[model samples]
Target chain A: MSQVLTIDGKDLAFDSGDTLFDVAQAQGIYIPHLCHHPDYPPQGNCKLCTVDVDGQSKCACTTQAETGMSVQTDSTTLTEYRRALTELLFSEGNHHCPGCERSGNCQLQATAYAQGMTYSSFKLLNPQRQIDASHPSVLLDRDRCILCGLCVRASAQEGKHIFTIAGRGSDSTLAVNSDSGLLADTNLSAEDRATQVCPVGALMVKQQGFRIPIGQRIYDQGTIDDLGNRRPQYHSPKSKTARIAGDSDD
Target chain B: MTESTTDSRSLTRVAIDPLTRVEGHGKVTLLLDENQVVQQARLHIVEFRGFERFIQGRPYWELPMVVQRLCGICPVSHHLAAGKAIDMLVGAEQLPPTAEKTRRLLHFAQVLQSHALHFFHLSSPDLLFGFSSKASERNIVGLLEKHPETALKGVKLRKFGQQLIETITGKRVHGSLVVPGGINKALKPAEINVYAKQMDEIIQWSTEALELAQGLYQADRKHADFGAIGSPTLSLCGNNGNFELYHGDLRVKDIDGTILLDHISNRDYLAHIEEEVKSWSYMKFPFLKRLGKDRGWYRVGPLARVLNCQQMDTPLAERARLELVNQCYPDQHQSVLLYHWARMIELLHCAESIQQVLKDSELTGGELVAPHGDRNPECYGIIEAPRGTLIHHYKVNDQDLVEEANLIVSTTSNNQAMNEAIRSVCRQYIDGHGVSEGLLNHIEVAVRAFDPCLSCATHALGKMPLSVEILSVAGHETQVLERTSQGEIQQRFYPC
Candidate 1:
């Protein structure tokens, strides 16, 4: 029999190198996440998918699944932590849902709704952010960026290394790799996989906004929990499997 | 307590703060002597919102979706105006035929719904019941209780308009449909058929509403003189001098029905109109440049449009327009109360127009965007909103961000007209009478006739409470009465 672990009191078989999040996802279980993408190496920075492993808390995306291990994905403490993390993400960014083109289809908005977050409890920063619209077809509005680094990883995977996170802590920002520090000067194209992975409205394909009317967009058709992080209509040819399986790269 | 003191020469200032049954916060102050003879009357706009300043540095294409936050009642007007401005900015001088028709459908829906809301829900209580009726019983709720069928019709009519908007744009309010050059989506045949089925019922209801408004105006001869003022009127008329709401040349007609100005392009508005700033009010007074400040002030909205336009395009509304012109022939109709009648006529026109546009096959499929031409740095977009002409001017930088924005909303155009109405009402109803609920409502009724959206004019935000105060000329409070936001009345008295 394959080595087994217990997640939320249910038995799950996992390969030796499979992470807890990977094993759970293989079993059709969802742990809320923002910084995790199946094609990229796991980054536990968001801490939204934190789960109870035995008696200690750990990020399911980064934690290795061990035989006979007991894991809990849902608990009062986990819910509070997840909700607070989502609220903090909202407070940090200028995520105006109604005005955003990604409004109904946005992952952050859908995740917030899943957490029942009507309003942010934390003080809003309303941080002034830069916009990079110099590109012919792509726009990088830092105001809506959550600094999840998915774009950074996807760009690196494509060998373009067009995006990166610069600075640290509250001063950290989504920086484009270009001599002029503008998206236009970068080699990034609208067809780049990195441009399609933005969970918010930050990295948008110019002139293609609101093309899919609201109430017909990705998240509008179903909740984030039900639809997962897949954007069916915007999937790249290389990521067809990932779109179908929600998170699996296979 | 003594008659000598009661008849003292010191003027008493009566103030109605936070006037109700209107869209935004406004106050009316009238100065009267002991005999209650009116001396001075003023309408004050108390709040200020700087939307233009904040819109700077934003991408030009975002204007249509962004500027719509100006008002909940008329977001579509702002959306269409900004879309038209952005169309010029992007150098799409003319839209695709399908795009133009789609926008026209959206605009007519907005006008139909907004007019239905104002006439049936907001002002019907005053018309159906007497204007002097008790405040508690003079509201939409009271109207519903007394006439459920009429109330239901109003609600349904508004719903149909909102539903049509949703069908076209997606959401009922603040939906994103317009893009820089044209609309984002075209209506499927099924969607157009949804509204097409309801056209006859909507047309019938609009005709009935028109009849009701006409009946009310004819029944009351006093309406002819109520808040009546003679001022020049302005609107947009097509190249053929036909009544136009979406796009046309600016036309100004004198009080005596003579064409004072015609065929003025919207792009040259600054050369013709100037806005004056006053110390007491946050709202600006826009006047015609040629006429000067004192004589330049003019009226807008349904009365102005009906008086200025040569003819209505639709057959039914054309007949209604002829009847109105015949009634007020030889002299322009200046009665503020007639605005209700004119608005109903437009509402009927919108209903008929909606049906006409839906039958066009171009709405189902065709080119949706025009090829952009040479981009312009600055441009103006002007449209006749339900209330009146709304102008949106913008200057964009090299980076395609808005460098400057100037908006003259419908209410701002009517700011001077509203103040004049307040003065007229004070002179007629409160000149020699003590402050009473009935008399105060007459002042509100006069303002309501203009349907001023103070929120849009001042670019402000917030709700209003009703408060009345009596003060001596020395600025000492003599009596104070307040109606809280929760609709509770509280009174306090002070000896002068």
Candidate 2:
């Protein structure tokens, strides 16, 4: 049934084509989601981009635009759901932001940082994901992938058709799918436009690596603040210990 | 790259590919006659993209990311401009004192790095190799052979600046760190002492560099005559008449040395400044409509900054300022070679200023941001780009995302002026019946003198080159236009 949703006391009408996340952003409410870039197709893989739709939960990225549907994108209840989701994503993935090349600009690191999720309370488990360092301009570390599907969509849709998903479900691994299993073996150039579109440090820019120092970036605090006090806010119940321990908190 | 000269000349019809003298991107052409006079000249800055236009619908918080893409070398310029613009958009200028100092120090670091790149990599070849040397080794490699110690100092100095940025931001290159409300990270005093020590060595290098740069013009006649005496152009910056780097009121002057707009808010930059697209290239020409076409040959950069400022601040710069003015015009030095010398003077000031700021105990973490909460007024941030005055203007909707964006980069301001510069250089060197590769290479290098990064200067994005042919009152002229590999073509034309 179609319904006008009142979220944080604002009237919002959900139509057939509206994503709850989209509606929330339009209403001046920010929802923290790393896997669901506004520009990329929603994976609902991280499940952090979840929102309450009508009386249930929905992954805002994959959820279809609907008509007259009431939606709640932010609240204490939803925040907890998001915290749990981001926490899991962090714990399941291997994210050593300080050591990662994409620490400052990595969406995963930024999300974890923004959500205050540092070290996982869950045992490291740190299952291994294959790391392919052969590609000159980009690398693939399966463990850090988050399986967000941003690289896949960007390469396939935005970049004419260089990348594809060969396997389905949990067996999924992003493959070059170009007759060869290697990235450097493909027709990709170092200046490949799609490769630069990655949200996390997963697809690292090869030539630009290790060029600048730690303290003097062009934008400073992960592109959110200069070198001063307006520090970025990261909160994740998963890494609650780190926040209190100065690793996650500003 | 070919240009045709005829009864009517258009700067758009010529192509000077692989512009020799600039830092990031270059190549321009001037169509002229047998009389050695230019009929038309097209400043074919073949790297252009619509970055401002691209960021139109992005969330305001995403501005730092978008604007930082302006220049790979000068990203700090864009970051600060965009951050200040957001400050205006959300009315959050009340950020605590710590935040302001953080930005100021970061900005200082960038200026240091950018100037080092310009002086050591872009222009040092000329300074070290004798401006008129016919040697093929006209680059950093050449400078290394002659002055290895100086070359090493240059690398370390630029590195120090980038190091400072990385330590605070977490990454050196593309950082999503700083924003409108406040700084995301703060510096520690203990670590800063390490930075200060390195800065001391850089200061020594800069002091020596100043002497070397001044000595070149004084002793070398061919270098002096070739580097000096160009048509003058004003570089506008903040500060009504005060000399400052990062922020202040703005003042515009003509190449003839007349002040136009003084103390104007960056919000009104476009209202006063008009950007014209030339058919020859992707780079746009920004002209003062009030001054009209040929007269709007205003430029921004070290030369322009020193000229526009009425008084000086800081002692080191003041002494160098006195020495630099002696090489000014009426002395007939059209070399445009003054960029290296001027940059060194600025570097001296930046280092000393860094010392002063480092001494501040208030630079520690606390009260950095004031939160985003307010109206959607058109916000504009106009600050001094290492190349010149840079402006970032944005109009946001109620949701605090960008409704529109317009950037007036330092390079854009000098587009018309650069066109003139190429024409003058071509007349001086390339206008004969035949042009050789080495000489032609030098002609392009002359344009490089300004370190013209059309990708940066144009407030645009990306580097794409397209060769086009245009037929007009003159004849068939080949021009290279700036286009993206994405198939986006940006062609512009300059008027006489």
lDDT of 1 by residue, B347-435 (tens): 99999999999999888688877877788889889998999999999998766778999999878888888877777777778767777
User: Weakest 10 consecutive residues, lDDT, candidate 1 chain A?
Assistant: A236-245
Worst 10 residues of 1 chain B by lDDT: B455-464
DockQ per model, Cα: 0.33, 0.07
TM-score of 2: 0.63
TM-score of each: 0.93, 0.63
**Tens-digit lDDT track of model 1 for A1-250:** 5799999889888888899999989988889998889989998989999999999999999999999999999888888889999999999998887667677767889889988889999999998888887886677889899998999999999999999899999999999888898988888876777988787788876655555665567776778888787542343211211121233222
Model number with the top TM-score: 1
How accurately is candidate 2 docked according to DockQ? 0.07
